[model samples]
Structures are given as structure tokens and as C-alpha cells.
Target: MRLRILSADERLQEAQGKTTMALFGPSGAGKTTLLKTLPTEETVCLDLEAGLKSVQDWRGDSLPIRRFADAVDIACLIGGANPAAQPDEHFSEAHHAHLRAQHPELAARLDAKRIVFVDSITDLTRQAMAWAKTRPEALSERTGKPDTRGAYGLLAREVIGLLKHLQHAPGRTVIFVGILEKVVDDMNRVSWQPQMEGGKAARELPGIVDQVLTLSLFRQDTDQDGAVSWQHDAEKGHARRLVCQSGNPWGLPAKDRSGKLALTEPADLGALLTKINQTLKG
Candidate 1:
């Protein structure tokens, strides 16, 4: 079969495309609440954490992700199929075709939305780990003992595959929200990481997405505390800010692969999307 080459116009048209972002922050930092800032008509939340109570008042459509299979099915439906995957792979062409045929309505619903918001990847990792443990690879053949390490390996592949599939979805903006964890080393050195069952997925997530945003409350001072307060305290300065670019003084985990965002931006997601789109056009 002869390979079809993309013309200059096709390449340039592809360059002006959608974005895939991963938003991370400590719990109670209003990461989920930021969904309210997105256009309700064009956005659909994949509620994996069951933590949409914060945005209960927001009138937007949401699909609850009850299990790991649900996540895989939804991702395949939204992103189509993985052409490079093996025939038997979960997100392979055959599997995706089966899913689309089985659930046409679900696919149609998701097709109408431009933005796919996954509530929390932290929960997705946990569920994936659980599902991985049930697989045959998680057990020692001779000893019949549970292999924790094997399960984690499978969990990482599952999570990364789902994320990459959605990241490549055409004409759609995919946003994955996760928990930011504070870790202390043996020497008392502290570092921030995304909460995941396996280290590999957490470490490689920043590379898989276009933007890595850290949503947190910033104060005038350099003091860092893990707490969320809505009321403004005159004595204690605290305001929610979205850290957009990397290498900031705050040491937050953030990056803009498009090279279009400022060091810091407002917490409003709608405005942020507009800014990113405008930069893409420019």
C-alpha cells in the first residue's frame, strides 16, 4: 500500500489544533470546581472521583466512570482507535469498533462535546491498579502468590495507554485532573509529585500532555501551606492562581509545551483556553 503524504496545508492545519492538559493540585484546592469555568455547553466531565459535589450547582453534562472498563470504553469512543496497537490490544481497532457498535448513543453524546474533562486521574490509577491485580500477570505461576510489582507494572501500562489515547483525540481538548502529593526524602528534602499507584505513569504524565498546570492558592509571602479558604483574610494574603509556565520561583509543577502562556494566569479555565487558542492562531 502506498503511503499518503500530508501536504503543507494539511500540516499547517494540524498544527492549529486542540490541546491536552493535565491539572494537578493538592486536595481542596478547588481543582474540580474549576470545571465551572469551562463552557458548560461544550464541556463534559468524566467523573471518576465521584467528587463532583463542589460543582453540583453547575449545569453541565457529566458521565460517571464507575469502573476501569468504563474509562477504557469511554476513551476509545472519544479518541477512536489506536492504529499502532496489536489486534488484541484493548484500544485496538477491533476493540474500538466493537465498543462503537455496542454503544452508539454514548459515542454520539461525547461526539457533541469539544472538551473532555476527566475529574481525577488519582482515582483512575487506584482503580486501574485494582483491576490489574485481578489479571493473570499479577500472580506468581509457581508460588501462586500475589505479585505487587507485577500488578503495578500492568497498572502503569493501562493508565498510560488510556491517557495517550485521549491526548491524541482529534478536534477535542482533553483535560486530566490529578492530586498533587508532597513527598519528603530520607534527608528531609521535600518534593511534589502527582498521586498515582505507580511511579512510571506519574513521572511520564507531564510528557504525554501538552500543558502541565498547577492550580493552587498563592499568597504574597513564600509560605506554603496545604489548605483552602474562600474568605479573604486581610492579615493573611491568599488568592487562587494558575501557574502556567515552568521554572517559576514557587517551584510548582507546571509547563507549557506550546510556549504561549505566561508564568502565572488566572484560575479561570475558560479564559485560559481562549488565551491558548489565540496564541495558536497567532
Candidate 2:
């Protein structure tokens, strides 16, 4: 195929497109609950964590969830090229056929959805790691010592493939849910980031997504009756909110490509999407 140059109109149109969001926060910070507010009818959520207990109250017909039995199930969806028939590749026709037969809904949603949500990318990473261990190349026949180092690379490739797949889906948005972990240095300085097993995936994931958000809570005490009250947003929203900043004081590594929003109070994806739309229009 010959390379063809695109017109100015085409280039501009592509530039105006929206990018996906990568949401990460601590458990009980309402990451899952906030995601529940999205319109389920137009969204597809992959519940790789099995029973999403926090979203138990969600009444939008069980939140249009698709369950993945294990890591290989997800690996099969993001195909690539591998003689081992790695989840990223379809080197074996039998492997692809088995995956399609088992996960038809997931296969259909791969590139044909408006909104795709993967509940907890951290879990996805874990699943990928598990699948990596099953690969023969990751094992040493001599000592039978598993190649833990090699598994990290496979895990990263799987996640990167998944992100790219969702990002290129026509007119669709992807939200990768992940837990935030607190790390302390030798000096006791603290920082928060996505909770992934492998250092490679956790370290480099922020650069792969359009936005990285951190959710937190704010507390205040009443003066009149000496009552304690809690409110998170400085401007508006609820008792909690999601924050996005490029190296803020809170020790979260976040970035926004549009540079339109600094924080999203109440930590709701629905509101974030609204702000994104408004900013794009402006």
C-alpha cells in the first residue's frame, strides 16, 4: 500500500477527536461507585474482578457487565502474533476459534462499542501475569524456576494492546479502572499510583492514557454547633471528588492532554465526560 497524504480538513478532524481516560484511585474512594453513574445502556463494563460488590446497588439492569473467567480470556481478545499462540496473537487458528466460541460477547465489544469500561486494570494485569506463567518460554525446565522477569514484559504487552484496542475503537471511549497504592521512599515521602503487580506496567501506564485521575476526600468541622462536616470539592459537587494534575502536591502522577480540567469533584465519570464535551466545544 502506498502512503497518501491527507487534506487539511482530515487532519484537523482527527485532531478534534476525544481520547480515553484512565481512572485510578484507592479502594472505597468510590472509583467503582463513581463509574456506576455512567449511563449503562451505552456502556459495556468488563467485570474481571468477578463480583463487583461495591456496585451491588446499581440498578441499571446489573450495569451491562461482562465477566471474564481468567486472564487468558482477556488475552485472547487482544490478539497479536506469536507462535506460542500468546493471547496477543492468533498464531493458532484453534486458539482463536476456542476464544471466539467462549467469549463471543467480549469479541463483539472489542471494536464495536461507544463506551467500554474495564473495571480495575490492576486485576487485568494480574490476569495477564497468570497467563504469562502458562507460556512454556517463561519456564525453566532445568530447575523449573518460573521466569518472573519475562512475565512482566508479557503482562505489559497485554495491557498495552488492550489500551490501544480501546483507544482506536471508532467514536468510543475507554475507562481503565485501577486501585491507587501508596508508596513511601527512604525519606518517608509518600506517592500514589495505579496498583499493578509489575513495575513496568504501573510505571509507564500514565503515559499511555489521555488522563490519569486520583480520587480523594476532604473534611471540615462546623463552628456553630461544633459539628463535623465533610465536603471534598472546592468549587462544587459532593463530599469527595477526583483530582487530575501534573505532579500535584498530593503526590499523584496525573496528566490531562486537553489541559482544560484540573479536578473533577464528586469523582464521577459522567460529570467528567460532560466537562470534556464542554471543553471540546469551547
lDDT digits (tens) for residues 141-175 of candidate 1: 88999999889999988899899999889888999
Off by over 4 Å in 2: 2-17, 59-112, 141-144, 220-238
lDDT of 2 by residue, 1-282 (tens): 446898876654554544577887777677777657787666667676764677776754323333323434444454322334455453345665777788787677663445667777878787777777787767776877888777777777766755664565446676888888877899998667678878877777777778887777665557798875544433343467677767665566577877888644456788777777667655
Write down the TM-score of every candidate. 0.90, 0.75
Q: List clash counts for every candidate, in order.
A: 0, 4
Regions of candidate 1 where Cα sits further than 4 Å from its true position: 1-4, 7-9, 15-17, 220-237
Best by lDDT: 1
* Cα deviation of 71, candidate 1, in Å: 0.6
Instruction: Give the local distance difference test score of model 1.
Output: 0.86
